[model samples]
Target: MPLNKTLSVLLLSLISGGALAAEAGTAFIALPGKAMLADAVRLAATVTAIDPATRTLTLQGDNGQARQVVAGPEVRNFAQIKVGDRVEVRLLESLSLELKKGGAGVRTRVDSVEAARAEDGSAPAGALARSTTVLADVIKVDAKTHSIELKGVSRKLKLKIDNPEQLKQIQVGDQIKGTYIDALGISVTPQPAK
Candidate 1:
């Protein structure tokens, strides 16, 4: 997907009430189009602590508030999550006691999850690497201007060929990897790594 399109989808999700917020005061806020927070919630948090025996996790928010959450058997190993690692928790169901006007019923539904990185690292889209570089595959080659249109796994990129010699060596279906300085330009020379 293109970055802009992905961002648009995310924004639409947020605007349509697909996101939820939980505060330290034990209050949950729901966004617009989706179900209630207790209805359908999408929360992002960090793992502060974990108990493998109990299958529980102590998650903290960016604001420093913490909550005790339990994981199901589907979660293979709690050890995979480290302390301070950001995690996205989707509240699928809550069986808490609620006082309603008519009657009481257990709540069960599906929700979304969004996780953020704990610290900034030089990794391509969260991959493990010391130095990361953005890459794009050539989608279209303009022989006239010596420019190429490329698309990555997550974004569409356009690159200008300052060196005609290097551009002559490139062709359609070629993969290029380089440091992106701007939308249509590269800071470093691209090489065929893959």
Candidate 2:
């Protein structure tokens, strides 16, 4: 039997609820002893079918790709979906690093996660936020090659400095403070009948 369609549930599965986004492998800001990289992506898929029985779905992408997907148990509130609805996905990623002094002088790390969903259930929406901070000692620096060795909580990391001038501000015995953040968010909205 052909399954009922509400296929954007697949997009819902992809969204996983958290944040806007960042570009891949692109540095947003770079300076001596400091660097930042971040990017974001937003996508919307139009729903073409909603069977309301088997949780099947048909969705069209911006590039005109259409595919079917089965909504698994991980998908919540599928009953709220309908044909002509739109599912949106938002993603964000960021990283920042700096060499500083006057730290505790020991390797350390911190992690955090946050999530939220729509309370009234008018629509399917959720988001998740995650972050981590790491403190490592600058054990070695190679000015010629623009490289540095960092001793972290459990191991060492070798990093190459893209800008030579940025390397000049760093030195051995300094504390390297770094923070990375990522977020994903998803939502569904009804469309006016046309």
Candidate 3:
């Protein structure tokens, strides 16, 4: 066989096996304090309290871990978050958090928040009035019920699909955009789009 053909076969085999295949090498996992301050860490916690004016959030993990997180202006609307509610947050380099809700549990301060508005075109002010946009990667897909498992920042989310056909188009490696609405409960609508 030609060299290129041989290489393609090997690559195909690797992808078919699994993306996170066990390898013979030293793998390192860092704990929260062990990592540098600039490093992003995801923590799942319950909202214990919220200081609206100060924009500080107090969260307690299901296992009893706790931390205070700050929300930035880019978050748009932090006032909607409530005490005793669950939330997932992405921490930016400026030490600000982007609040995301509707996951397995509450997650906080794991990564930077991308800008909400599209850069290619201008959006009318308040165009995204009722919803918050999230960029997440699909971690798991359930074809049976048309639900998808997503990982945003440090939190895992299971989103229900309004259009089963749209869900069918999603693959594990696909990236997704989710719209989150806050009401008596947090709800997420994720669609498979570039």
Best by lDDT: 2
Model 1 lDDT-worst window of ten: 180-189
Worst 10 residues of 2 by lDDT: 1-10
Ranking by lDDT: 2, 3, 1
Ranking by TM-score: 2, 3, 1
Positional deviation of residue 174's Cα in model 1 after best superposition, in angstroms: 52
Determine the C-alpha RMSD for candidate 3 after optimal superposition of all C-alphas: 23.6
Candidate 2's clash total is: 23
TM-score of each: 0.27, 0.80, 0.27
lDDT of each: 0.42, 0.71, 0.43
The lowest-lDDT stretch of 10 consecutive residues in candidate 3 is 182-191
Per-residue error (Å), model 3, residue 50: 1.0
**What are the per-residue Cα lDDT tens digits for candidate 1 across 1-194?**
43333333433343244232433222343222111122333455566687878766676655566666554443333345556665543333222211122221222222233332213222111111112244456677798887877666566767666556656666666655443111110011112245
Q: After superposition, which runs of candidate 3 have C-alpha atoms over 4 Å from their true positions?
A: 1-42, 89-194
